[model samples]
Target: MMTPDEMMTLVTENALEYGPKLIAAIAIWIIGSWVIKLLVSGLNKVMDKGKVDPSLKPFLCSISGIVLKVMLGITVLGMLSIEMTSFVALLAAAGLAVGMALSGTLQNFAGGVMILLFKPFKVGDFIDAQGYMGTIKEIQIFNTILKTADNKTIIIPNGGLSTGSMVNFSTESTRRVDWTIGVAYGDDLDKARAVIKQLCDADERIFKDPAVVIVVSALADSSVNFAVRAWVKAPDYWGVFFDMNENVYKTFSKEGLNIPFPQMDVHLHK
Candidate 1:
């Protein structure tokens, strides 16, 4: 409604008041971005030095970078005199909704972090958990991949894996193998025991320090059971077990020992 002079004066006043603020805001943004990059780089080096898991390193770096950039954006927005309280509240509300929606996923992610930190098992380790047994193929953020003995692939959720009981077969360097050998009740127990001990002593894979145990464990309905226990390297357990079984059968047959089978003597009276 006024003259042109009024418009020019108002414009000049606004420029005088806000021009420096705009320039300062731009400078802060530039400096903040540079600082964020430097800080993130330093953090990555620290994580490397700490030996963080390889799978988690990239995710951690990405999350940290995003958080720093978001903070910088909020700071720049604040310098521009944008109302941030409402924006912050809106962000909180949205975060709450998303968090609720992805609660299970977040739990799995947290569990994965714990697993990477604690290292219950590693890739290629054989593990049994949650009614599944297999060798671990991968440990991911949400799931663990397993390849079973029968060549089946299984995906197990990390949430349950972290909380449930896990048996890591590869954790120890050596393992004990136990077997029960049943022979006919009339078989010579001392001869059977001697032959079993001889076979165990000849096996190079079996450890002698623990000393193999061959004892008459029980007398069942049809046969006498001998408990054979031996220690072997972790990797040699399965091979030793199968070989011992084969050796027992062959030696027992050659020695004229009878392996008892269930038999019913039924007599019909007419």
Candidate 2:
């Protein structure tokens, strides 16, 4: 081993030899940080000009900035005269481990990105997906929020929604309302059809173009079932459905029609 004084001098010389590279790395880091900020700011301006969704903008900007800064850090490490090969290998290994550990979470993140970009649905839309039906309340990076018709809040993972089939009812301008009305077998089928047709004509919500269909649907043990189908604008669908039910009952009653109820004849064998 060398003397203490000799070792000290050698150590000082090594540090002096690498001192300029270290200084350069610091300089690059500081300048690159500012450059990254400037680039992120410019990107934000471009995205804003594109009129992207408000909720998606900030997340995209943040992810972009982080990626850029990570690349800049790698560049700085190269300039610092440090052995970057081992560092890169270690980083790769760490990333792989983390990715494996958080596979489910990463899937959700990817799904969220797809949702933001493609916009399969949006807030306030009444949707059915993954066996859940509700109005979307909010959408976030990991999950989506929903409010059920019964006023219950539901949180759904983005991964499931992104991969599953979804039905957005609110997107349609019109929907069909269907109901089966039962009448006594002895009642006049022709007059029942006329009365239902009159009821359909009187309803303003029912669309006139496609027209309404009223026909015998099935022969039940208790009565003859007549199916009534009408189309109405989506916004007025529920209202129209309830109103039609009430109107049909009243119309049948006023027309002296016999509404049938299920009956069973009981017999005892002794």
lDDT leader: 1
- Stretches of model 2 off by over 4 angstroms after superposition: 1-42, 79-81, 266-270
Error of 2 at 245 (Å): 1.6
lDDT of 1 by residue, 1-270 (tens): 978999999999999988888999999999998998898889889989988898888888889989988889899889888889999899999999999999999888888988887889999999999999999999999999999999999999899999999999999999999999999988888999989999999999999999999888999999999998999999999999999999989999999888888999999999
Tens digit of lDDT per residue, candidate 2, span 1-270?
899999999999989988888898899999999998998889889978876667888988899899988888899888876578998899899999999999999999889888877889988899999888999999998899999999999999999899999999988788999989888999999999999888889888899879999999999998999999999989888898888788878888888898989888999999
lDDT value, candidate 2, whole model: 0.90
What is candidate 1's local distance difference test score? 0.93
The Cα error of candidate 1 at residue 135, in Å, is 2.1
Give TM-scores for every candidate, taking all chains together and pairing residue i with residue i: 0.85, 0.80
After superposition, candidate 1 runs with Cα above 4 Å error? 265-270
Candidate 1: C-alpha RMSD to true structure equals 2.6
